[model samples]
Target: MPDADRALPAHPFDDDKLHEECGIFGVVGVQDAANFVALGLHALQHRGQEAGGIVSYDPDVGFNSARRFGYVRDNFTKASLMDSLPGQLAIGHVRYSTSGSKGQTAIRDVQPLFAEFSVGGCAIAHNGNLTNADSLKQELIERGSIFQSSSDTECIIHLMARSIQNNISERIKDALRRVEGAFSVVAMTRSKLIGVRDPRGVRPLMLGKLGDGWVLSSETCALDIIGAEFVREIEPGEMVICTAQGVESFHPFHPIKPRFCIFEYVYFSRPDSVIGGHSVYETRRRIGVELAKENPVEADLVCPVPDSGTPAAIGYSQESGIPYAMGIIRNQYMGRTFIEPTEQIRNMGVRLKLNVNRALIKGKRVILVDDSVVRGTTSRKIKDMILDAGAREVHFRIASPPTMWPCFYGVDTPEKDKLLASTMTEDEMRAHLGVDSLKFVSLDGLYRACGQKGGRDSADPQFCDACFSGDYPVKPTDMIDKGFKVKEPA
Candidate 1:
């Protein structure tokens, strides 16, 4: 279904295929809520690693929406832009392209899509994908409903439109009953902020309180931005309504075991962000400790690449008796310029996202811990930068095992052919990354790091592990880009 849109360029790097699923946040009952929502969206930028948006409600003007189809800070930080947007209630979304939702003009596609229904103007922002979107859309389209965006969120809006109810909560529940997939939704009516997660709790939505107002978000990290104290996570398949009446919650989906996407703890969420009830920092630290025990590396300093790698580096340092130090400093101002137009610009790799600290790395044997390698491009560039910075040796260490297959369930690891580990031998990978030596933690090490991988974690173990094990949750007949479909025709 998405083939025409994903017609990639002939050049490998020119093809911008790898994508990310992202973060969403909503707040009701707070004055100056737009500004606070802006701050909250900033913290959850890691969840989406792509675009951001926030839409708010005004008693006088009705609804106002402003979105930056890139990072929140860079996109939403204009003095004039902030003053123009005024509201007391708001909903926000940051997106990664995990669900193959990208189109010809994604900037135009950026959302918190605003729609008008008979009841009034209601808007919705969504995180997570719907496995049943196409079918649902087909059903809706056949019923004469029109769609403005290709995103599955439209179906929810359409469903709500068909329902006959004055109360937004009742309409949302009626709509929620028709869908079955991993969806964490936050919808805003003229004056109400509503939150819902699918019954199985396939995704996450948490509730927090800031002063007397109520906040709903995909991660607790967002709440921290607005000084909102965590009240509780929105229960699986539960609907939470936040208005002047406080909150009214409901459950509408069939119950199933929670499969909270362990990868969220591993690499998806920011370390400071908690998933379900687990600490991302603590989880990565455990990974590092396990890696040290299973694949001990002899290095002078355990250093991280900054941001995502810090937690694992700390764990590795504690587990291996290696001192953890800041060997690399990030160029927070730089756009992960990996998206630049040419290889000439892209070649200046680590300098784009980060820069090495010469004082820390010069003449030192450095163990560089990172999350995972996809195209082998970023890893290679980082290694070269460390060497250029004068590290005596750059030993590469990955916290997660190699991503050998593609992920279909919400991450954009679409095909195995482009994956580094899927095709190359480990030695080949080391050579590609241009490291002095390289070692990945064993699969066992990675799992043990997860605190009983076989036990009850919020996410299921039979994850769309196609990215690592090459065994998809629901295997395809062949990789013909059926658009996340379970099997090709026999």
Candidate 2:
């Protein structure tokens, strides 16, 4: 991804920026996998603007793939290129890495990776993390296995090859059991489109249908992009197979618990995307309502940071009876804007991709609603921008609770020290942002707003709370830090 739209600071100092996560999409039982993949990926662009790729499968020629580390448009703009990726079944991925995960940062680590064996060919796309991947990869490597990428997903591919089983479903089940993590996988084979969510359902995966098509997408938002009707989400702890023989469903390892990532409602998902029966919009709107109830602020108007902040801002405005306004105009064409690398740009940065509406911010005391504050660099710069824009006062309202921990399930966030909330108290965080007041949604408020904090057997009863609570279902070892080098013997 290009940093032209980036919050580039001329020098390093106090600045502001937020990190982004990636998105996943897939369409099977379709006539043109590439075209559908392109369309679906486009819809998911908001998930990860950094890189994109698609894999098309045809029995006659094997798997045909196209991958680019930039925006989807950068690679899939030509009609002929789409022609090159010919197949009726396809799965694709878009990516954003925070700073750690080596395999995740490399473009090659982008999804829809393919591996072939005597058993058959497999192309898989995944969203979320594998806690045990580092250990699993080390074990596989010790057994003389070679890895092409740093992704945990490669572990799954390698394990499937190692299984040597005749049954594909059994192979997937076996591989899934050995690994502990939060994954929602969409795997494509010569004859089938298989979808599986972790037994805990830490992430979102949905099943959809259009005409004679059976669609397996990371979220229902992709289904809307391809004119597919929303069917129910793939059940947690269950595997759903959509193939020519018809659809089959089974639960071999039921966890009896659900923990979908609360961030999906706060930041990761497109507000239009519905997961586990809760519309992202509804989830966010409820957050706003909850915010109004929890923190009543006196401001002239409720202004969201824009885009992701709009729905929650609207909810806040409606519930608080404050009119909502677009205080900052986003430069949509600002390319793939990334975290501002330095401080000078941070000091003077006023939205490399955002423009403050002087008319909106000039005189009124403004309340700014944003999702979360990462490095505090971006938030500080943005707050300073609002202050410089002539605002009477600036109050920052974060939709979710303070993110004190880094996400391991592939959110691409930076290390713990970089997380502003991780090192500061609410008062300290308030002092850093230079805002008149700083408030974040409480843990209870966030859970209640997202409709994710619920008991067992609830309709949408899955949530990934690993980041907030350090009970990672799986935690990789320091094979990277402690040096798990697979260099051959000299």
Candidate 3:
């Protein structure tokens, strides 16, 4: 997930940043899987806030599902809702519509999508987007395969249902092999709980153990929420099946170097969660340290943009020997501006979300640390707020490199034309935002912060930085020959 922000009414704010894709959780061997799933989804609420759904199966009751277009706490916490879903094996999803397809926002599109086949029934919850979904959907529809929803995830269900494989797990592997792009999926059959990650591992998924039970979730934090001890991440291109007997693993794809999403360190994942064996909070702090070394600034105080930038700001202060101060305070209750639905509402979003502290920033030359700069709307508004607070000078430092390209796998990014960094240099952006100085951490520096000492090696990169560099590992087959603007699936 990029940020813990929501939109207004039915759509999210229209701010110039990325909206998170989704989060998935599944558990087997627990007597109350739905309860554990609810709590796990609550921990992952920051990943996606649009809607939540859970599907569970019991030997007697069969498969049951419940989906609602609201927060997990608001809908999944109710006793009635829980009563409606009873089972020992369960999988759940919290989604943010990544596509513009019609009915994408409808309740029917909310996931943990269920499908019944000759073999048995299965429910799947996906955490990333499939780049070749449209092409696959077209072929499937032409073959007379009817889709239940407009979501790309539904493609997996239909594909699996039509597979010639004998078992459900093999059918799943068969279905996945036909698609391209990122995915971290948790699925459930009548007696088995399954988890799989894309070959590139573009998304994240972890395995954990809770007493005698097993769990799979998008982040380790979800495991913590349910008292599940962290096992290991479900290996990239690996599939794990958990049942009452035990757990088994399979390699569904050919071996290759893994390229986990680098943004997970910059913005996604809870600060408390760990990714690729690195602490998210620590990675953020290291990013700040790297930024300070690469872009030195002499300022009275190091101020953070709030919550998201807090850890980085602390690291910057320590490295630069400057005092850290909370110069900007964010409102806890406001949603992100992107969901404002209107330009007028989005224009007022910054003020509603953050305010400058006159006492801390007054007459001070301050360095403001932020995670990244998307469209530059938030940065510009923040600079104005600092100026109004009587700050003599404002210097902006970004933790990650400029997001030069849009994300096609999952994260909802603005088109290239809408991205500020895509069209402007650092100096131009600084002038545009009315800041005295602006410096973004170098791409290599970002890699170093993620524990890659020699920095990004284009030959064999350690992680996915495609948004910063236009080197997408996946072919983006559905988007090619389209001038970088992949038409959404019809």
Candidate 4:
């Protein structure tokens, strides 16, 4: 079992926001594919900063693998390391450890996990979590399957090894059919690059075209990094096999309604990326617009919480006709290891990343726009900073609905009871944060921002708003077996 206490963020205030899951990218028919994979992973560094790994298949060299701790730019950019991994087919993964031994991530736990079988050598990188992993692991162990790493992704390799299928793709299909929950997988064999999305399509995986080669990435931003042309998103319950000859698509699972993760628009994805034809930046702006309309408060200035909150802050300003100001400036160079050893410096958490613009905040009734409040610690600290800078009042406007439930589909979230929204009402949260006022974009408003004009259909939600609405599309089987109760559908 993962040590939840140890899984806390290295920097104190880092835990104030929901951590991203993982990023998977793969390419075929490209020269020095590992180089491209490294660049793609770099673009996706926001998703997972803990570790990164790449696996490349060369005809002469066979399969080459390299996994490293820290950022991709630091580890994979070395000429010596990149030279070691030479091939035309490659897949890479950047991990934040939603599963396995969190905070104490071992090198083996890093992904693009490779396995050799009767069919051939195949490397697989996975993006989401498996809800039934615990049960599946126990069953596999009883049947004499030895585990390599603590990761749930290793289970897929073992299942594939035991499958009676003749090819890697068929075995993958077989293994996935038995597991439950969200997964956007990218696997590469000797000649083929394969991408698969789970039946629910809870996580993202998209296809891209690069000259004679093909690409599969978690988001379009990575494609843009490698100069790859945007192709369509990989459909739910669909698998695409990419080879030099052509790309082949297959639907190996029973078709179901797609409930893609709605939070991608709110925080997970890069603002510049586009998903399902909607720009993530535009969606966040729309969310801010909705927030401004729903909760119109008279304030002297609209200020963003910095980087993540900027676009929404702009939208809120435009909608409310409140002038936007850079009330908080972010220190982009700050990393997790900066002066974090001492308790006093640890307490000085949010200040290390963000500083209040005293001149702009002073004597102003500031309307602070932030993406979401996970624990309310950072919000409280930011509010205190604004007040200390001479702000008359601070009102918090959150871009997304309250996050009341933990995400089981890959996002690293605090326990149910730890979430501030889970234990407190809106008014309670406002009081807890010590803000003059607090309001969040409603669930219906969020759906409207995502292009659902009629708002979320309660009977059949268009997207997975489980974190906000507590209506999990896929049952968290492992959590349930361990006595974790889910919200009963209304």
Candidate 5:
């Protein structure tokens, strides 16, 4: 079998956390736009690490694309590859495969999924999941559309191809109107760089300006990577077409209240990025403060799980007046694709990626702050590591509420039954993990951390908290059709 057909081994540590499906970046009116796109994708690599691709449009070369399985820095950084993708307009994607074949991600599934239409050739990089994709795919297939990739993103391209609309932009608007769910798309034609967000805005898309060029990215941090100025967020239900002259904004879909993913602040986005004018790092820190206020405990030191949990740990330490220490040190060089070929290495699990600070943790009542607990396996292992390091007691404080539901909006999540919180109460989880105590910030507290002072609007939420509250803004049509049960409303 080819490399694409072979199932890639899942990193033991990576299986425990939720993953964003992909990140998208596009640039127009710049020399070698693919280079800027490469930088942007590198900045957003945390969103997706499985595969990456870039599609560039040059007047001479027409449309050129390169898709590969692995990190952006590993592939896109090659001078030869960058040279082949030269263009004034380019769009790119870093994919984690939430909507397609899971472990066996084929190169064809790697996006900036390009398709030639009657009007023109367009390549699109999508950063969210389409809830109605399966049903739409079936419908299209019955109508004689041959599928190339199993990816849900292909549904959009086919939808666009079948449209009677005269222009690519109009076809896109028409196609999106028939689809349901979250999307922040960066698409490109020969002359135009297009950006769009779903009606509910369950994903993030930002517009930036670099000299005379225009940039669209999944996060503001990608803009910063290319020295682009933060222009603004592409509003929910809006689309913008960019050219050398200027940008044109349109609300192609019916208006709906925006429900941007709340988890982005908690774990998905880079710490340095800003969302809706709030710094992601600040929001995470505030979440820590809320966690401390709601679940105060006596401990000698507050220690973060490392990386994602650091900001929240700081806030928790500050709020509780406890000394903060780096009880766990992460292996900076470890990549998610590191293969564990032996049973011994597989059993080592998180130890491959993280190590305990023996001296700091020795005899200390350590309060460990983390973003969230999914399967609880990682938490149990970490607790054992802390105990082995001579810690007197181990306590877990989660910045977000228990993730009881699986996300359908472009996040890779375990089935609901597999989630630790879905089947067990807090006390049961604490006992199961062998931790002295366990607590998660309440959903309302999470809202407060996101700057919603009055807490979540029960009647109509301000953000998407589907994983916590089991209230989905857009009905997960594909899953529903597959007989997946959604939580009943209270």
Candidate 6:
């Protein structure tokens, strides 16, 4: 377990935002495909840091695979490893645990989960969670399917294995039909690479092209890493199969109104990447502008919590006419505090990661802008740190609406009962954090920032705002059937 490598930090203030589930990358018709996959996975390392795996197919050797528990750079970047995985076709995955799963330390659970069928062999890598996996797994096991890994992704393989369809594409379609919730899947056969986005497009998958080759990745940044030209985003409810003969498209699922995850702009994606034809950085800046319009605060300066909050803080500063300052300096070497083990280590983790700039903040009324506050622990700790540094007043401006509901798609959010906003009012949250004021961007403002002209259209929502709004696009079948209650929105 990752917790065994280092003590899992027990601090309340550790990691108050949602965590993306995993990243997927695949390429076909590229010489030294594994190397390109390594670079692509490196670019996507931020999406998943716990483990990475790559599966490649060379006609001579058939299929080759390497799965390890650690950062992609530490595992996939070595020359020897890449050489061993040489092929014209490849797929890779970097993973954190699937949402709601725990104590999963087995490397077998890592991805590019492979299987051999009587028809032909293939490898699959998936981002996002399956809401109906448990029910499917139970049925499959009852029918005598021996499971290899505990990951929900393996359920796809099992379903594919039992599929009556002869063609690989048909089998994949059949498997997907049995599952529910968000998925952006990349798969490989010896002669082809395939990418599929679920009906609602709750997760992101983009198509790129390089020298007669096709690439598919969870983010556009991966395409940028390999000098691949952006082809287009794979459409919701769409599947693209790339082969030497060229590409073929299919829409096997019944169409629904697309609802891409809105939080991708609020946090998940790389700033440089484009989603829905808009730059993520620009979207975040626009979010800041919306927050400023919705909840303006008077203060001497606007400051960010660092890295994640930087762009929004700049936007807030510009719109609110508050000077933007880096009142805290981050220690680049320190890892995230959420992974720290003991409370003592957790308490020290923040100090080790960030230092207050006492001179700049002293006696200044500071406005701190951040993406969102889940548990409020991190916000409280930072508030104390700033006050101790002599800030006269602290106000918080959040770029997203209160994360009152837990995300069941792919993000690792706390259970609804544990989310601070789920249980507290704005006044209670401000008092708890010891801040003069706390304001979150309204849901409509967030939608407008995403380029929705008249704010959110409830009848045909533009994106998935389940974390902020109680309207989940897809029913969380497994969670609901298992008796896990979703708290009613306050």
Q: Which stretches of candidate 3 lie above 4 Å from their native place?
A: 1-14, 100-104, 335-347, 485-490
Listing every candidate in turn, what is its Cα RMSD in Å to the true structure after a full C-alpha superposition?
4.7, 6.0, 4.2, 2.3, 1.0, 2.4
Candidate 1 vs candidate 2: the lDDT winner is: 2
Candidate 1's TM-score reads: 0.85
Error of 4 at 154 (Å): 0.7
Best by lDDT: 4
| Candidate 2 lDDT tens digits, 1-490 | 4433222221132123333455666666778777887887888887766677888877677789887766787777679889878877888887755322532355556677888767777888777777678778889999989997777788888888888679677788878878876788888888788889888787778888866767777777888988998888887798988875568998878566666677888877788888767888988988888888898889998899877778889999999998899999987765644344466554445466677899878999998998777777767777888988999999998887777666766676556677788789999999988899999877777778766445222233345654554344444344234542222323
Provide the global lDDT of candidate 4 against the true structure. Answer: 0.93
- Off by more than 4 A, model 6: 1-14, 335-344, 486-490
Ten-residue stretch with the least lDDT total in model 6: 5-14
Q: State residue 137's C-alpha deviation in candidate 2, in Å.
A: 1.3
lDDT (10s digit) by residue, model 1, range 1-490 = 3533232222233122334466778888888788888888888776664566788888887788886655687767777777666778988888765543442325435668778877788878887766667777888999999887667777888899999988667888898887755678888998899898876565678899989899988788888877899999888778888986699877766776555565676677767777656687898998888778877867899998677778999999998998999998986655543443477765554465578888878899999988777777777777878888888888888887787766645566646768888789989998887787777776656666666655332244523344565443433322333554333233
Ranking by lDDT: 4, 5, 6, 3, 2, 1
* Order of quality (TM-score): 5, 4, 6, 3, 2, 1
* Local distance difference test scores for all models: 0.73, 0.74, 0.87, 0.93, 0.92, 0.87
- List candidate 4 stretches off by more than 4 Å: 1-9
- Top of the candidates by TM-score: 5
TM-score per prediction, in order, is 0.85, 0.88, 0.94, 0.98, 0.99, 0.95
TM match of model 3 to true structure:
0.94
Instruction: Kindly list the per-residue Cα lDDT of model 4 for residues 1-490, writing each as its tens digit.
Output: 4442222334455878899999999999999999999999999999998889999999998999999878898899999999999999999999999999777787878999999999999999999999999999999999999997888999999999999999999999999999999999999999999999999899999999998999999999999999999989999999999987779999999999999999999999999999999999999999999999999999999999988898999999999999999999999887656634588877777898899999888999999999999989899899999999999999999999999999999999999899999999999999999999999999999999999999999998999999999999999999999999999867
RMSD of 2: 6.0
Better structure of 2 and 5 per TM-score = 5
